[model samples]
Target: MIPRSISLAIILSILLQCARSSTLDDMTLMLSNMPEDGRLQFPELANKYGYKCDTYNVTTDDRYILTLYNIPGDTRRPVYLQHGFEDSADTFLLRTNTSLVAFLVEHGYDVWLGNMRGNKYSRAHESLLPDDLQFWEFSVHEAGTYDLPAMIDFVLKHTGQKQLQAIGHSEGTTVFFVMGAQRPEYNDKVKLVICLSPVAYLHHSSPPLFPLISLVGGPAASAALSVAAHGDLLKNSSVAVDLIKVACTQKLLSYEVCAEGVFFTAVGRDSEQFEPEFLPIAIGHYPCGSSVKTGAHFLQIAARKKFAQYDYGLAQNKLKYGSLEPPLYDLSKVKMKIALVVGKADTLTAPKDLQLLRKQLPDVVNYHVMDWEKWNHFDMVWGKYMYVFLFNHIHEMLTKYYV
Candidate 1:
C-alpha cells in the first residue's frame, strides 16, 4: 500500500544502518587507530591479551549493530559492561588485560562489554548520512533507553539468563541509572549494579569546565554552532577518527564527552587542568533522531532532586510509548544486594553521589573506592595506570559479589 518512493526510502534507511558500522576490517585497515600510548585502543590491546572483538546486530531486521567483546571463560553469571561516552568496550579491554570483563569472565562470570552510540562500535540508526549534521545530536537518554537496553536484552537472550550483573562507569553509570529509573522492568532483570563515579550530581565537575558548557550548550550557543555549521567552519572534521586523535588532546573533547564534564574537568587539580585529554572515538556523530526531542523528559531528575526517569520518546506514526517519569524505583526497594564503587579523586562523581545512592538502597552489601591521587573522570577506564590501580580492587569485589 505504500508508494514506490516511500518504500524505496524505507529500504534506503535500512541500508544506511547496515552500512554505518566501522567493521573489524576497518580497524585493521586503518594505520591511524588510536596511538599505542592512548589507553582506549582495543585492536592493539586485544592483541596483547589475545582477546577477540565480535560484532552483533542490535536489531533483528538491522537498525543498529552493537560491537561487543567476549573473552572466553567458565563463569555461569554474565556481567554486562557498558562503556562511557565517546568511548567503547575497548576502554576496559585496553586499560587492563585482567580487567573487569576478563576478570569476571575468568572468575565464573561471562563478561560482555558494550559500546554505546557515537563510539566506534555503536554507530547505527542515525536517520541522517555520516556527513549530515543530524547525526551528531545524541543525549544521555537515547543511550540509556535504546542503546543500552538493546545490549542488555541481547546479553540476557544470548546467555540464557533471566538476570545479569551490570557495571557502569561515569556517563556509563548515568545511562544505567536512567535505564533503571525510566525502565523499572530492567531493575527486576538485573541482579546487582556497580556504579563507578555515579553522577546524579554534576556539581563536582571541575570549575573551568562548567562555565564553558553553559556558555555554548544553551540556545544561544547552539545557534552559533548552527551558524558556523552552515558556514562549513566546523573544526577538525576531515575524519571523525582523526578528530578524535586531536580533540581528545585539545581539551575541547571533554565537552564532547559529557555536558557537565565541561565544568567539572576544568577546575580542581594540579597536573590535570580539566582539559579534554586525548582518546579514540569510533567514527562520526550518532544520529539520535527522535531521542533529542525527548530531552525535557530525562532532564527532570536533575531538575528535580534525585534519580528519576522523565519519559521515553515518540515514534512517527505510532502512539506515544514512554512519557511517564520512570517509576520511582526506590533503591531501598531493590530485592538483590548491590555493591557501590567510587573513585575518591574522581571530581565528576565525588563520594557524595555514591553516598546518596547508598542512602537510598535497601542493602549496600559492599563498598569500594579508587582513592589514588592521580585518578580523574575518565581514568577509571582510560588512565595509563588504571590497570595497576583498578584491577585488584575489581578482582576483590567480584569475588565477593559473585561467590
Candidate 2:
C-alpha cells in the first residue's frame, strides 16, 4: 500500500544490477581459466571487458563479406581502426584495455575494427567459397577499391555520423592512402588519420626470403606455386602453418618462432617490448590470411621503392593500365590532415623511406617519432609498454582533434 509503482521500479533496478554483476563475474572466470592455445574471437573478447560488442557484415562491391566489430558507445564521435598486412580485427584487440579498440571505446569514442579480404573474419563471398583458388586472387588494390569504401560507408550509415576519425596500422595506412588517392571522395569522410608504423617506401627493408623471390625466383616462382597450390597461400596443410602453430605455442619456442615469424618479418626485434605470455595469443590469429598476390605486391614495393600500382608484365600492364608501367598512386589527392606515428628502429618504414613518403603528402599535421629509439615496426601494436608510452601520445592527439 506504500506506493506499489515505485516499489516495482526499485525491484527492477536491483535485478538489472545483479544481472550485470553476474555477467562480469562469469567473464572474469572465463579469462582466468583460458587455455594457453585458446583464442577468443572479437565478440567474446569485447564482452569479457564489460562492453557490448556488435558485429557488422559488410558486403564489398567485389562480393567479399567483410566483418567489422563495433564497441557500442554513447559518443557521437566514431573511430574506425584498420589492421595491417596479413592481420585481422583481433590484432587490435589482443592486449585488452591496452588495445586501441578498448582505449577508444572507454574514452567515449565509438570504435570499429575492420577485417580485410581473405582474412579470418572476412573470408566469405556472395557466390564463391573460401576454398576456391579464385578467392585468393587479390591484393591491397582490391581492398582499397572495394573493402575500405564498403566498410567506411557501412560504419557511417550505422552510426549516422557524417565523418569519423580513422587510425591505420602498417598496411592499413597503405590501403587508406590508396583509397584517398583513388577514391578521393572518401577523404572528406575522415576527420583525422593517425598512421601507426606507416608502410610506403620499403626499398631498404625486405622481409626474409623476399630478396630471393625478387631476384632469382620473381613472378615465375609465384606462378609455379600458384599453379601447384591452386592459388591458396599458407594453406592449413602447408609446412609453414604447421611450424608456426608448433613453434609459437610452446613457451620455450615462442621467442625464436614469434620473433622470427612476426618481429623479423617486419623490422627490428626488441625482446623487451614483447610479452611472452601473449605470444601464443598473438600467433593464433596472425598471418590471418591473404592472397599470394598481396604478398607479391609488398615485394613489388620493396623492389621498386615506390607506392605504385600492381605490376603486371609489360604487355599485361599496357592492356590493364593503358601503359607499359604500372602508374604510381597520386599522393596529391590525400588531402586530409594526417599524423605519422613513426619509430626510430622500424626498418620497413625507415626514416629515409618515411621522408620520401612525407614529401609526397600535402598536409601533415604531425610527424611524431616514438620516444623509444628501439621501438620497431610491430611494437605499435604488440608492445608491452604500449599504454604507458605509445597510447599516451595517440590519446593526446585524439583529444586535441576530438575537441
| Top TM-score hit | 2
* Separate clash counts for every candidate: 16, 0
Off by over 4 Å in 2: 1-38, 206-221, 235-242, 260-262
TM-score for each of the candidates: 0.66, 0.86
Q: What are the runs in model 1 whose C-alpha is more than 4 Å off?
A: 1-44, 60-62, 96-98, 105-108, 126-137, 216-337, 384-389
Model 2: how far residue 268 lies from native, Å: 1.2
* Candidate 2: tens digits of C-alpha lDDT, residues 138-244: 88899988999999999889888888888899999998889989999999888888999988777666465465547523445555555566656664334455345
- Computed on alpha carbons, the lDDT of every model, listed in order, comes to 0.53, 0.76
Q: Model 1, range 269-339, lDDT digits (tens) per residue?
A: 31342223333332222111122222332234433444543333223112333433344434544545566
